[model samples]
Target: MNVSGIDIAIQKSERKTVSIFIERDGSVSARVPAKLNDDEIKDILEAKEYQIFKNLAEWTQLNENAVEREYVNGQSFLYLGRNYRLKIVKESSGIVRFFRNTFYLGEKDQPKAKELFIQFYKEKLNSKIHPIIERYKDQLGVAPQQIKVMELQNRWASCTPSGNVNFHWKCAMAPIDVLHYMVVHELAHLIHNNHTQAFWNEVDKILPNYDEQINWLKINGSGMDL
Candidate 1:
């Protein structure tokens, strides 16, 4: 619906949530649970849609602003389960350097700060992810056809019917054990293909503390920044 003449893309899911998003153009889409009937949802769109859209828009903007403020120019982020700040600098020197408790990125070219954040994450943390995966692979005895790292939107990691495993790059943001658990979880799917009891048993046999990783992901593992 148009709040200030913006068009929105609405998405409905089975999960329990009700939210509205303000498009960059000022249009808003009301995201609601699938449990909501068309009539109930229609009433919302017909009445108070503007107010609802505006409020959600404000909240979205505020949250984005906070993230930008915290992540840019001399801000901190949790990486490899530790706190690392983005230290903006003016030197022709290290654009992204890691000290004892901080990550430094040169802001001489501030336009690419986000890109620098990503590059720093990849270069500094990727080497560490493989060893964790190898440890679990040995424990599981079942190996995925292929392991791929990428940015995931809906699911943290996925196992294709072909037995390939693709992990969300953000999994790097999780603790070491948690990353291992995810690798093992996906590897288990390479054998089981579904979330059945035997599948869970396979997981428990190799990763006894799978529940902890599950809880961690639930509490802390998702972001599209939108």
Candidate 2:
């Protein structure tokens, strides 16, 4: 849907209020109440035009530093929020391996470097997030049905009505403190569905310095990619 010269992909769901988001790829999405008609949605979009434009400008500025990486020796990659130089080795038992603060990729795996890196992140994220989830679920007094580390497109993390929490594998590239904030953000959703004050209050209870992590992501997120 294009409203007021802005293109937005509209998603109608069981949600109560309209929410606008600037996706990671610089696309706009609006999640609206399923019952809203096109006219009503248009009106809402028009009303929020200023905010949307402001956010889009910010997204543009932030993504200016987006990283375009190569699968070559001396190229850097992120692991646990730290930069590690990539080394293509002629022989390796695995497609990719991390050792001594560096990423080692088998030369034969060069054709599938992106896939191998994604697999590496997925495996590492699966192992890393479980313990963090366990620690927070008990503190938040909520239990998620399941936790998954997978491709979530533009979102770093999200929670479902059924209590399932999903984290993007790219989150493995964030600093540990920022990763903790992501975990707490999703677990808090099990308690409050929206970003209301009460919902943030719940997050603040667990991570008082959460804003710092949020800012860190805003500044560094565009570079956390293959």
Candidate 3:
């Protein structure tokens, strides 16, 4: 589908709502009910034209900071906001590990090193996020059903309508304090569904330095990828 001179990929399903978003690769997409025709989808996009352009501009600005990382010796990757050099080693066990101030990947596994890094981040997020959530449940008056760490295309984290909170695994690569900011951001959504003044107030009450964290993400988010 095409709208406002931009091509959009429309996916129709049994879903009853219509929503549009920009993808990680800068493509536009719309998810609508299967019965909705192309003209109706175009109308919906037309109605949201302003929001779509705004988000596209923001995405462009964020991608300007994108990092090009090569999987080779001496290539640097982030973990807890610290840079670690890549070191490929010849070993029978194909695995990736952080040791001696370097990230070690078995020579045989270098072809899939990005997957290993993702798994490593998931492990770190699993071990770290639960405690933080527990500490804030009382203060925020919201207890989520579960906290999951996974990959997200265009968001750092999200609080589902069911009260479950999911944080992107890339969040584990951020500084501990920054990661906490992301947790608070999603948790605040458990109270406010949208970004209203009340939501900012709630976030401020918990993390007084939330702006710094927000700025950090705006500047460094593109670098969080593999």
Candidate 4:
């Protein structure tokens, strides 16, 4: 849908309220209640036009430093919010391994470097998230049915209606504190499904400086990709 020269890919879903987001690739997406007609959706978009433009401008500024990483030696990759240079070693024991503040990749696995890195992030995020979840679930008094680390298109993490929490593997590239914020943010969703004041209050009770983490992600998120 085009509204006032802005292009938005709109999706209608079984959601109650309308939500708009600037996607990872810097595209605008709007999710609306499935029952709304096209004219209703267009009116909502027009009303929120100012916010959409502001977010798009911010996205453009932040993405100015977006990194296009290579699979060669000496290229830096992020791990736990730290940049670690890649070392292409001749060893065949594993596809990729991290040690001594550097990532070691098998020469034979160069073609699959992206896949290997994703798998590495997935494993690390899986191991790291559980402890954070355990720490917060008790305090929040919520027990999620399951936790998963997987590919999420436009979110760092999400909580489903079924009480399952899912985190994007790229989250492993964020700082531990940011990881905590992400965990808290999703867990708060278990209590309040929307981003109402009560939901933010729950997160603030846990991580008083949660805004710092949110700022960090807004500034550095573009560079975390492979």
TM-score, per-candidate, Cα-based: 0.64, 0.94, 0.78, 0.92
Per-residue lDDT over 29-143 for candidate 4, one digit per residue giving the tens place of the 0 to 100 score: 8989999999999999999999998999999999987999999989999999999999998985556799999999988889889999999999999999999999999999999
Task: Please count the clashing residue pairs in each candidate, in the order shown.
Answer: 4, 0, 0, 0
- Using lDDT as the yardstick, the better of models 1 and 2 is 2
- Candidate 3: the clashing residue pairs are none
Candidate 2 at 102: error in angstroms? 1.1
How would you order the candidates by TM-score, starting with the best? 2, 4, 3, 1
- Displacement of residue 21 (Cα, Å) in model 4 is 1.8
Please identify model 3 stretches exceeding 4 Å from their true place.
Answer: 1-3, 7-58
Number of clashes found in candidate 3: 0
- lDDT tens digits, residue span 76-144, model 2: 998888899999999965568999998999888899999999999999999999999988999999999
Candidate 4 weakest ten by summed lDDT: 87-96
lDDT of 3 by residue, 1-226 (tens): 8789888888887766777777767888888889988788888889999998998998898889788888788999998888899887788255578887898888888888888889988998899888888888789998899889987777788889999999889988899889888888888999987666888999999999999988887778888888
lDDT for each candidate structure: 0.64, 0.93, 0.85, 0.92
Q: What is candidate 1's lDDT per residue for 136-224, written digit by digit as tens?
A: 77677766677677665546689888877776655656688887787788888877765568889999998888898876654454332
**Most TM-score-accurate candidate:** 2
In model 1, the number of clashes is: 4
Q: Give the TM-score of candidate 1.
A: 0.64
What is the TM-score (0 to 1) of candidate 3?
Answer: 0.78
